[model samples]
Each structure stands twice: as structure tokens, then as C-alpha cells.
Target: MNFTTQRIEDIVVFTLNETKLDANNSGLVKAEFTLLMKLESVKKLIIDLTDVESCDSTGLSALLVANRLVHANDGDVCLVTSSEKVLSLIRITQLNKVLSVFDTLTDALQELKSK
Candidate 1:
């Protein structure tokens, strides 16, 4: 998966460039995100999935695990989901209630800053 990371002041913004986030690419996502979360000063995270095509259970699990880690550090993960398929998966898994999802990356960043 292709990705880029930037800090929105204290919050980090991770934008996915890939069209898919499945088992084949979920591991990379987890590793990259885990590394970012290790920063002591980092707090909130905004995951931009505007270009994401689909997400599988493994991808969802990776995101959930990352969210948990962020929460443990008094931070949170806000997802910018533009993919219907991904949103459907989250809905089916009842993860939408557990994770904060936004329609745009800007909205996600705003929510993160508010927190």
C-alpha cells in the first residue's frame, strides 16, 4: 500500500494512496501506522481512505488494533471513508459505532483537533 504521513500540529494525518486495503496490504498499513503511533508527542490520527477501494476483515482488524493503541495513549483514530464498500464492511461488523468515521479528511482532522 502507498501512503504518506504528515502532522496536523499534534495530530497525525495518514493518507492512503492505494486503491485496496485487504489482507495483502493490511500488514503494511499496520506496520506503518504502528511506527507513527510510537512517537511520544503524537496524539490524534486521521486516516484518509478517500482512495481506498475495499477493506477486508484483516484490514479492519488492523485498523481496530491501531485505534485501540491510540486510545490507550489518550489519543484517537478518525477515519475518512469515501468508499462505500469499506463503509459497508464497517457497518456489518458494527465497527462504525466503535470507530469515528468522517466523510472527508478535513472533517476528520477537525474532529481530531477538537478532541
Candidate 2:
């Protein structure tokens, strides 16, 4: 699997298992995540990119789709990653202002909980 998901209470966390989130698998990522958003019980989502070494535009698009879905459902979404490359791409694309990003899984979860 490209990612593993664990749901605790109302928050769902997706831990990417792939090293690169590029065109090849971004569609799969988007499709699966979209389905998660439809789960009415899910109130928040945390995407953990700890294993993702890099990402492309398509990967970023997938993230955006998740964000939109969450918001449409009146929920929140957060990202957890330590990759400088991924973080840089997010900044360059000006998505940093749109998405909440954290350095650790704990931080993301805590922020989501507090919100």
C-alpha cells in the first residue's frame, strides 16, 4: 500500500509509505483520501508525510482535494512532515497559508484536537 490509515475517534491519520508522491501514484492517493472525507464520522484529518521524500504538483493537488473535502464537510485538515523538499514546495506554491503543517505527528494531532 502507498499509505496506511488509522482512525482514532474523529481524527483520521494517513501515514504515507511511499518515498515519492508524484504523478504515478497521486491519483490513487487522491481517490482514497476523497473516500475518507465522505465518512461522516471523520471530523479531522492528519496526513503524515514522514516517509515521503518529495512531491510533485500532482501530489500537492491531491492534498488540496483532501483539504476541500474536509472543509466542505465542516472539518479540519493538517499535515505532518519533516521533509525540507516537500515543505519548500508547499511554500513555493503558496499553499503554506492554506494548509496547517506541523513537524511532528503529535503536534498535528494536538493542534487538530485543540481546534
Winning candidate number (TM-score): 2
- Over 12-74, each residue of candidate 1 has an lDDT whose tens digit, in order, gives 888889888888989988888777777654568888889997989988988887788788888
Local error of candidate 2 at residue 26 (angstroms) = 0.4
TM-score of 2: 0.94
Clashes of each: 1, 0
For residues 17-105, what per-residue lDDT tens digits would candidate 2 score against the true structure?
99998999999999888777665556699989999989999999999998888887788889998999999999999988988999999
Candidates in order, TM-scores: namely 0.93, 0.94
Error of 2 at 73 (Å): 0.4
Residue 99, candidate 2: alpha-carbon lDDT:
89
Error of 1 at 53 (Å): 1.3
Off by over 4 Å in 2: none
User: What is the Cα-based lDDT of residue 38 in candidate 2?
Assistant: 64
